[model samples]
Target: MSAAARAHNPMPVLAGAVLVVMAAQQAIVPVLAPLARDLELPEWSLGLLMTSAAVMFTLTSSPWGRAVDRVGHRTVLLSGLSLGLVGMTGFAIVCQLAVSGVISGELGMALMIGTRSLLFGVAMGAVPTAAMAWVAANTSTTQERVKGLAQIGAVQGLAQALGPASGFVLAFAGFLGPVWAAPAVIAFALVAVAVLLPKGPSRRARAAAAAEAEQAEAAAPSKPLRPWDPRLWPVMLGGFGSFLTLGLVVVCVGFVVQDRLGYEGADAVRMTGLVSTVVGLVMVTMQAFVVPRLGWPPWRMLRSGIPLVALGAAGLMVADTLVLVTACMAVLAVGMGTVGPGYVSAPTLLVGPAEQGRVAGLVQTVTGSTFMIGPLGGSALYGINDWLPFAVGTGICVAGAIFVWTRKGPGETATAPAPQPELAPDPS
Candidate 1:
């Protein structure tokens, strides 16, 4: 196909590849309990596994973003997928060892942390950074950028719904079945990416582009951006607040179902699953359908979403029945769906193309950090009082809303220059 055609429509291939990888990652959720039981590990050990992965993900993202800028998206993406495949295979082997009494429970858990958590976390960071960088590079207009990024998030939402169900069903095949399935899924994604993604800019073309960017930077020099840079503060703050809220809800919801709603064991698990599915579907619907049609700028979306999140958290604080809780959670989902794409796209608009990868990485890093902080913080507050977390989350969301409202929207561009000297020219 022609370059124009590829540029015009890379989403299908990118979205498909991302969906597969994300599904493979999320599939672990359903099998966590079963794996813990079979391996004779404590349930809380699973939480530690997840937390370790999040830490790796957070630490690696910025570097991976820099790699995407240096090596090109396809190379980084393929490498990440390969790492994920190896990681998943290793994790499956560890599980099989535990089941067969070939390894002690402590050793098995250690192997899981090394493979599934650490290795897979690095892959998670690489894939999303590459995907977002690809979108930012391919899409010319602001609206197109929003649509492309939103579609990525929509696919993730779909995967969040599909992965657990598929994993649960596959578990009937045996202890190793679901564990092994993740590598197979990633292998498919790797092949799809290799075949479908167009050979992006050639080495010479990238060199020329880089040289041009260098000249532009020389003409108007600017300082490097820090994590706490003023231009980036709003986007980072908004993302941290949004994901913190999400993390709190995700961790606490099951507890709330069991403790507050008088459900227990299998019933509580089923209810939590049902609620999660509904939230995922609502998020997918909003990002895929509602966002594209709204045609609102990123700033406007942020302004609108933050307040809704605050309101939803407040509702969840008072909700007693399952139906009421579901409604409140749905509200939170909508708010999250709206804010996510905007938080991603807005920073790209303010800078030049050269810095897209770095910005994408920084954004992912902030998000990862929140997931790490949110769950532990929420769990602690919930232990104190169920209402405390929600009340605090509501306050956080409201503060985010106020900050975003007072700032300039997407129409207002910041003076931050794209990363120029730091990014090596792409060489195929």
Candidate 2:
């Protein structure tokens, strides 16, 4: 990799943009239930905020990917952050209204859901779609794809480390402090993206890549990558199950720590943040340091990880101490760190450059589907009993992992596949 290639590669700025998006969303998680209680909302309302956004994320993913294909990465990145800033500001206003008694709990929840989840979900969806598409379009081999997707997981892992801690710190200013300040952070990220994200691939470079993709499509007879496609469904199932388990756990963590360990109010929020920090750090260490060196194949990552996840969840069901609980959380994060890159990389190896953006969107859709329903389910089950959600969620992970372990690699087609489209050299 040379300076020129490095100059054109999108991952670095793309990474910063991704960090901002993930951090901002996750920052709200730990305090969400407490804030809802203060505003006199029921337990189910807690999931509504994320669920609404997730629903939109799932619904709009394919279109967002096509928008990137239509408009180019730089344009979409700029616009997405810009919209996110607006949504963030509007969300803050809605929360302030509820906190100050200007709006009723139900109305404020509805307003916040529309403002934050719906608009924000649509806006933030673009960055990851561009990222996955870029990685898919650029990498030719399974090893390279795994490394690239691992890079993504590592960035997200870092965000997870920071986001919860920041929220905990910000909560000192008041419950609404993180909410009010998020827009400014997004505004700053938007500026950085404008300054740092590249204009586009050079005209000649774009023309050559386009021509090569056209040639490959003509030869392969292009079909739009489908979520239900036979070659891809196994990977999708693995991702959906693992992440759904994540959704279940995350939404319940603050409650679990608070109830099981006898923490309350701000202490619960802080303890939840502590649990998040442990998980985040572990994921970062695994994704950044351990994964690239192990050189394991994607399915191995899937099979190896899901069982760990099940074990972790099982521990959570029985563990009474905060220390034990945090240990379980750490084990679960390890599982996430392992499965994530595999889930991200495997499908790209099964397709051509032509389908990268669509695949990216579908991957995002898989993640989105979890948040859409998982949060509400987790919260509801927890309300019934602390351990019930984990029991059910662990069961799901076991089922999904077994499915992956029993099946052969989808990338191992019956016949050797067509050559990958030639891509530009990566940046140094």
Candidate 3:
């Protein structure tokens, strides 16, 4: 069907898929210590497991994005979810075996990392890449695109807020409970995608679509842009800086709760969870309610958000009480809420529809890279001095503001690309 004729919005299904996948991925986080004990591995080894997953997630995103562009979003989404199901199930079985004394320690750790960390990481990269690409391809107007992306971000934030709590609650059943639950969640997502997501064009139709798109692009004065084109650097850097700041705060805040606020053990954990939940709520509120109402352009959102983030980081630096810290972190979450959708949507405005998958992949790659670097970097800086990570994050946010402020907003052609047909799945 033509772009003008495409009326159904797939954002809800895509967002639902993202929520389930992210929840499953995050559900294991709160149980890592228990998992370590159950598997008879050191606590730090579990940390390595998480690090390995981040590494794989970073490496696989771009390729998966490119695949979405080729094979279609529905195909890629289902494929990724299938992989996740397999990975989660495998990891759970490994955990069960280790706990039951059916597998040795070293072998079990290796198997767990292979299935849970590496394989699951690859699936993690694929799901979001396809989902974002689906959003970009399905939405015809900038307003629609921004709203769709914001919804995705909001759902993801909600999932992050609820995932750990679910994990902690499920632990009462057994350590393997959360582990097995991840696959079941992914299974449901797989069914939802298969049933609800619109089908893409057939091979011949896609070929024709590509040809027509290419002809239109050639006729237009402006050319198609690559993901790494200079015009997109501002958006890319803005995304990286925003998430890097977030990573720093996530890793360092617990230490601050313990050392600075005199909270420790379960008290420290509870305080940290409370702060994170508050942050997630703030982010969800902004993205879901505040951003759509404002409807500002992506560049404008970035300009407004970056300074707030810097100020929030500065607030964290001086905060001496839990109340003060929570207030500061709320400020930080507000900034992130503003920045997140803008970062995702801005690049889509710059590129044509054909490039959306690649750009979305690049955005996810930046996020994954920050996750890998931020915690380790923040921990190192914290080791040097308690205040160091927040200070450095402040600098990063300030630099991000300046970087975005200098870049030109979307040009006329970029603001309104030719209406290409939606990349829906085959209806048959």
Count of backbone clashes, every candidate in sequence: 0, 2, 7
> Relative to the true structure, how large is the alpha-carbon lDDT of every model?
0.74, 0.78, 0.75
Model 1 clash pairs are: none
lDDT (10s digit) by residue, model 2, range 173-195: 87676777688889988999889
Better of 1 and 3 by lDDT: 3
RMSD for each of the candidates: 4.8, 3.6, 4.8
In candidate 3, how many clashes are counted? Answer: 7
Poorest lDDT segment (10 consecutive residues) of candidate 3: 419-428
Cα lDDT for residue 332, candidate 3? 92
The digit string of per-residue lDDT tens for model 3 on 1-428 reads: 22522566566777888888888876766455444545556534654676688898889877886677667778888988999999999998997888788988778889988999888988988887777666665565556665666667677889877775666566567645677889998999999999988787688876665565557446555544444578787678887898899877666776677678986544454566567667777888888889879978888888889888998998988899999999999999899999987887777777665565456666776778888877667766777788889999999999998887886755322655445444443221
Question: Candidate 1 on 153-197: residue-level lDDT in tens?
Answer: 778889887775566466556645667889999988888888876
Stretch of 10 with least lDDT, candidate 1 = 419-428
In candidate 2, stretches whose alpha carbon ends up further than 4 angstroms from where it belongs are 1-10, 134-149, 198-220, 349-359, 404-419, 424-428
Question: Estimated TM-score per prediction?
Answer: 0.77, 0.86, 0.75
